[model samples]
Target: PLKVFNSEQIRNIGVGGHSGSGKTSLMETMLFAMGETTRIGATEQGNTISDYNEDEIERQVSINTSILHGEWKHTKLNMIDTPGFSDFYGDVVSGMRAADFMMIVVSAADGVQVGTERVRQMADRYHLPRFYVINKLDRENVDFDKVYHELRERFGKKLAIAQFPAESGPNFTTVIDVIKQKAYKYAHDKSGKVTEEAIPGNLQSQVNKIRNELVETVAESDDTLLETYFEAGELTEAQLLDGFKSAINRQMIVPVVGVSATANVGVHSLMDFIVEYMPDPTRRPAIEQDGATRKPSDSDPLSALVFKTVSEAHVGELSLVKVFSGILKTGDEVYNPGSSKSERIGQIFLLNGKNKKNIDQLHAGDIGALVKLKSTHTGNTLCQKGKEFELPPIEFPEPLISVAVVAKAKGDEDKIGAGLHTLHEEDPTFLVRYDGELKQTIASGQGELHLD
Candidate 1:
């Protein structure tokens, strides 16, 4: 077996926000900062990795979830950048199921908007470990305190500020680390490099105050920590780190970090937090039908759950799978336990936002794609032959909007139907059916705007 370097805790992160909230731009910056891409591609130029679909480029909006992978601090990070519009909420739901944590990016200047509340409620429903990012701090009229207060009021006291912007809006050059009591002033380069510095002179007091609050909130999750904090009035850096991890692990607190994803501000720190704080698949107990607990491990027989399938024009179909136990490799024979049928495994590849790189093997708790598998659909489970287990498929929201598009010419009818089928295969949230009641082919999604 080839040793995998940089193997640490794996956390699938989901990011969602309102349309024009810079979700795509944030993802672009994150990829560029991680060295996944050399040049930071812009949405306006139709070259960003996440916005690869023709529709997304032409409309200048993300229509589907763009899944990407990044490695930070030698730990692999898989992220799904989701569309924020209501019409695309279905895509958001599908993405949420694959993520262990959710990052809700909000426009700092805009405060808590409609989609913020909606996505927050959705994340709560799924019991996902959620963090809020007040993005676009470089923009004018941005109020970090007001936005922070609003989020606290909405998300409750469990909402803690992990990082705060040093300055309010434009001229924002530094951020306060609520846990470390330090400041990071980002250099004005496309590659976001920050000079470690002391907390800004003017904000030192506020920084200390917020750091204390963060420590206290984190300590609330552990009795010993709470007692120590209440009596001693402070927590050491190591204690604060431990307490913060415990708080998030127990879902007792949600950390709010600041970032100008456009300016690449706080992006590296955000990625580091995700790797350091988020729980691995093994930490999450599996839900079983017979009331028995199962955690992903290599000791058990091979088991995998299919969460998505995308059919490329030239590469055929790729099945995005999460291995629950044992090992899966190229050319291994496995059974679709959900279907009670055996199928041959093909080549395995790690998907990087529409780009696929070949890999030989994937272990339990790993996410990757398999090429040309037969008799398996999204939500199906693959395991050793004669071993049967079923994982609940992702529950997507009901379509709230519908649209009917017809071919402009007679011969275009067949092409449109085939194209719709491919689209359905790519995104299960997109439902296509012949509406007998209306005598037209209707496509249903989260909302009208999404359908458009």
Candidate 2:
């Protein structure tokens, strides 16, 4: 395993979509394909890495933003798996703030829904590079063409198909890569093995048409490519690939791919596409505060943002951070401007779901967790003592539901108070207040499950 990664070799992607859209399944497939897990664990069985929390297992939904990572083709992919329900949208906001790009998972059978648009708006707000994965293609009556067209109409014409299903429903086994102009058929055993084949004779015309559109989209991103396309009437594959990467980074083109996460079809192609087209952390916009920008580079002064705080059974408080500039090493002293306090960092761990692997240092554009900070909370900036700047705090929605807390046993009120305070520290979206008029302790959250 690579102990450290440079800025260009790291890709932070936020996996978000509506409930039951198979975002977790897609993440599980990616981890399995990358050899991070020996076997793919299903969410229903409560064995998946990301949804390991007890609450998640009982609810069968992601309650917190899970930080998961895997190395694909030597490039480290840090995936932020977020909740889809509106009640837990605060987690989605944090995931968006931490990711360099977003992969919005949409169900082919369901097409575009309310949660899909909500996540799209969040990505747009951050101006992150976006892509679409139309999942569950093996389900009965699934229509790739319909979803593809609907995405273009709803999002924009800049949305283009990078890969499409060769067939629908149970027969869905092959995907035609528009960029590569090749068809890949998945094996019968669902091992993620694919046999390359030429484009089907009947689909050749359609492929050519979409391929041309893709070429045009790529060419328009660069002046040289556009002039060459006009002069030569075409572009070579090398030129198209170079321009496509640039176009994707500049947000000129949004590529859509098809996949069946459960069937393990087209997932390999999707992972390859991410490595090929998704921009690295350096290519993304710099971290800015008060008109000061910190580009992603190890040479810059140390600066990192604490995006999440999790309390474990024994480890205590763990602050998850993304290094926006310079490097963070274990035992370094940094100041948190939000908390107006100084703290010493202890051990730094690269997060894999609930698991943590110790690492000596984390460079710019990397995400990791530090244990036992003195006063830093979520949305705080930690940097060199004299060089302090804060990133914008995540905007969480106001609580819409409220409930009164009453102790079942006398003298347990102090315990409940302490527990509520701890919960508030862990989740900023949860609010607790002592109602003087009602003479009750009131707890509020976006919804009932949050309070629960």
| Most lDDT-accurate candidate | 2
Name the best candidate (by TM-score): 2
Candidate 1 at residue 83, lDDT? 82
Model 2 Cα lDDT, one tens digit per residue, 365-424: 899999989889988889888887777777877889999999999999999999999888
**Lowest lDDT block of 10, candidate 1:** 1-10
Clashing residue pair totals per candidate (backbone < 3 A)? 1, 0
Q: What are the RMSD figures for all models against the true structure?
A: 2.4, 1.6
Model 2, CA-based lDDT: 0.90
Candidate 1 at residue 105, lDDT? 88
Tens digit per residue, CA lDDT, model 1, 1-452: 33342213566777887877788888888888888899788889999998888888998888777678877777777787788777777677777767777888888878888989888888887787788888898888888888889988877999888888888676777878777678888876647898878876898788777777787788888999989988888887788888888778677999898889777788877776787787766665565755543457766777777877877778898888877777788888888866777889878888777998888888777778888887888878887776666666777677777889788897897898998987777777788999889878899876666666
For candidate 2, give the lDDT of residue 334.
Answer: 91
Off by over 4 Å in 2: 221-225
